[model samples]
Target: MAAGNDTRITEPTAAAGRRGVLLGAASLLAGAALPFRRARAQDAKVNMRISWWGSDDRHQRTLKMIKLWESRNPGATMAAQYGGLIGYQDKLSTEFAGRNAPDVMQIADNRESLIASGRLMLLDPYIASGQLNLADANKSVLETVKVGGKLYSIPWGLAGGCFFFDTKVFADTGVELPGLGWNWDDFAAAARKISKAAPKGMYGSADIWAPAGTRAFYPFEFFLRGRGKTAFTEAGKLNFGANELTEWLSFWDGLRREGAVPPAEVTALENGYETSPIIAGRSAMYPINSSIASSLQGLSKNKLVVGTIPSGLGSKALPATQYGAFINTSMQVYVNAATKFPKQSIEFVNMITNDPEFAKIQLMSRGVSLSSKMAALVTPDIAPIEQSMVQMVQYVQEHATPLYVPWPKAGSQIQDLMQRTHQQVAFGQASVAQAVTRFIDEAGQIME
Candidate 1:
């Protein structure tokens, strides 16, 4: 009943894990109470608690990896806790507050505060002492997780933002399938054409401000970078001005008015691929990170093709400018600072990240591995959808500018503000100028 404790001490079978995850999701939505257990240090034993939020596939593979780890290392025991992504932050935050956080947990894109707040174990010691291996990891990729000269986490999967188009829909609309050379103008025109041709109850595209689709701020950030503007500087400062954001919002507005994208009301219904117009055959395209490629494909029977994020004028004009897709560390593993078994935790992290055997089990379910060796290990068995994702990431690395810097401490708050104002502007609750002005003022206050 604890944050990390299950009905049984060992890992749950796949079926049991699925049931637990469903129950966890239900409890989260209903706001029902869950019993929290305090950490208990068993004397002379390496019993450690680990937790993560993932799909059933990830959960099952991770459980097998845990069992393998225990088998390989005698006198060790790992109690596992896993669930879906909804309400994960609140649950983890509660554990941290109660000083009962897991030894190892999965960290997603928004862990700047967790690192800055000193709630994560500084991983440098483990790396230096060779308890955690990173000799084959990409150094540049490794640098992305550093905070204040200390590494608090390691990437679990590497992916990039991409445009996923249903080939059949594009063909049906008589629009060219998007590829590397596609630009914003082409995108807009294609969206309009697709919307006109789509079956009833469908639109050209989903609103880019979709909260449950790609990260709400991604399209805005991509636009900024395409224009050679910084959304946020390396120092965690706001990089673009109100005028630029206004232009970005105005672009979306044009799409809405021209019927090139769904209206605010339609977009409001679902932010993810499951119910998205694109997946449901109402739209021609969906924009999301490469990691969601298979999810999109699984939900639809259409032949989906991976496409580049639509480019801006600067990328075409300069040819060498920092504008293109976002090649980013999409998922990461973080150790709880309060863990009693740091060595055991580091070992688990190392095995999952670099072990060739473990890599085979994981395949590309977590996106392409950042380590070249692990990627090679998993490449042969990779599914077609996953292969597309890997190729997409590789393409972004070769073509685009570096991804945006980690958000400042107030990054998540700023993102939420942008999502709210974007909706207001799209729905006519506020004008473009008014929304931009309000956002700049409030965001400036938060950054200050």
Candidate 2:
């Protein structure tokens, strides 16, 4: 999409600023506002701003969870601002610039810019002070949220990447279910077979816009590892060249041109399962994050099954870490650097991440719950949905390739380059080699 046409739906930051100004005016005119007077006299009540981006269902559940926290703690009140996925980062950036950022904000997976801007509160002091306990949180998830050797945020849940397939379609096509060890050649052959057997309206696969950070780049990185290379070197320099990238791009271009997958035009317009060719039964397979599987359930009239990404040709099939569902490199809640009530804010964040009841409400909203106890509670409510996600997670834990260190600064931009490169190549605007070279050049500029 064009940058100008990007619709930014922020929750009235200007209005919030106006409210703050008006409150100051009222306080000056009347000597003190009633709430301000109460706040000053009482045991220092903390009113915190909490913000995140999600759909309406997520908002409702989060609000309910916050209400429960409020009921338990009478002295604290949290004001919330929520938006959809598309414009969240832009809105958050605006709020941060205005110094009107929430006391607690959900940082995205690729949030190096936010970290670099020093907008987030470091949680190390809180953790070291014994005010926050992260003993139960996954170590990998914790590592992802850490920057400059200090924990800046805590993951709300785990997310994994996997391919969603129509089980019946595969069965009817006489294609065996994909196993953890299946290689790319196996996948290609299956796609061809499935394409032949698929009905007129259905194709073998739907192409997703390559993810811009851990979500998109990590999976392909995993694939590259099987070919004996990494995207970047130990010193965080681009290690692979145009030749390798051209091969990867060529694979997907071939798929598109061969009619195994829909064209980029069809895929680009689809933002989610409701509009996704796979969920609409126009394709037999789609690779997506596990969190979205729940949303896909209702959208798909057929039985949807989760599977691993295919391994490289001839190499030992390395199980790629289920990129989306694992807790590492996930969305996190961080305290604001300027909050007056840091302790209460941390408690509130703890309430959302550590509290079982509240965490249950966050089920599949962020991904699967990170807390095992909360996962137990939420899974029972959404048994079938949760089961599929759990199976994928377990498969990755047992069978996937070894996990790598989380990417550092400029990680997000690198992924963005990859996605745009894929689009350029898939649309035939550039050859695979040209696309790869362009990506490297653009990524280098961002890294510098």
Candidate 3:
């Protein structure tokens, strides 16, 4: 099968089993295969380094954007250091501790840990000085990146949770595309049906509860938020107890038993979009954010589309979805406080985020255009896949709720616990009850 053949996967599950064999990183390094860097205009007046991890497309586009920036800026230059999830955080932390961190750092799923470093350059001064443009940016979205009334990061774009489905797989399976406001029941049913219709060894869905990289695509947290619950409080304590964990884990466990999701033995840990079960055609649906539209679609020949994640509206007693105008989009672009080129670094960030030309060049690669003006400029000319990303962002923005509570810095550790507990259950090392207790106990430790 081709890269995006949809129904039949060319690469066997055997290959995917190795993608997560090592200590993979997070969503920021989603599509990385190796660590690499490019130093542009090494002799320029101002040579600044920016560190980020992203898919191949993201890296290419970002490098292109930097190239454009340098052309116009003349003396200022860029050193783009980036790669896959492996060693990303370790390398970043090492640099920060050494007080030689990159001028601009794009912290992804595990941004809070870095933000807690207390060494990131405060962006407030730049905003106040009119060096950074925010007059047209979303106020609510901007608020998500602040800590203690100080701005530490600027969002490249905005994104919300959504399911990325292979249209070809759905067509082949004769399963209807997921309808708006679909719930857990509907999702499970569709998964089972798709599995039955798919080729042998393929599942309706990947084991979503399993570890992807080190962090991001937090289904458990998102599930709880949809039902008006928090996994952890602001102070870093487990908000809801074992009952919530039991409920969520049990559902995925049941799916594993029903062939709706991959079994533990064959469930390959998703290393990145390039190696995921969905991209390989081994699964039909994968929960992803709207921001991945371009990168993911570009890798697969199968037609891919994004939609709102399942909701509990009209069915459950609590809230329905975790749609927010500013979901994970504020992954936070931080400047190193110790950097010498504070002015240049902030300007580069402002250019990438606020400039019309860069925004159009990037499209939905980073995410939905950051400002309304950017959106208007890009929406009319965006590709079909990008259009869906934009639409998903709009839908979430319109129906967002105030119930969302931000996770603490320990959020990533808790996510690791979730993955560990999931493995225990899937491998039958521990029952759901045992996993719940362990998760709660371990998560509390992480919080404190």
Reference-based TM-score of each model: 0.84, 0.81, 0.84
lDDT of 2 by residue, 313-420 (tens): 453323333332233435577877877878888887777667777766667676666666666677777647557767776666455444344465778778777878
Misplaced by over 4 Å in model 3 are 1-44, 213-217, 315-326
Q: Taking the tens digit of each residue's C-alpha lDDT, what string does model 1 give over 154-206?
A: 88877666778888888877888866666787788788888888776667777
How many clashes in candidate 1? Answer: 2
Per-residue lDDT of candidate 3, residues 386-436 (tens digit) = 787777777766665655456688777777777788889999999999988
Which residue pairs of candidate 2 clash? 159-324, 159-325, 159-326, 160-324, 160-325, 161-324, 319-400, 319-401
Task: Tell me, by lDDT, which candidate is best.
Answer: 1
As a TM-score, model 3 comes out at 0.84
Clashes within 3 Å, all models in order: 2, 8, 3
**On a 0 to 100 scale, what is the lDDT of residue 207 in model 1?**
78
Deviation (Å) of 131 in candidate 2: 2.7
Compute the lDDT for candidate 3. Answer: 0.74
Q: 1 or 2: which has the higher TM-score?
A: 1
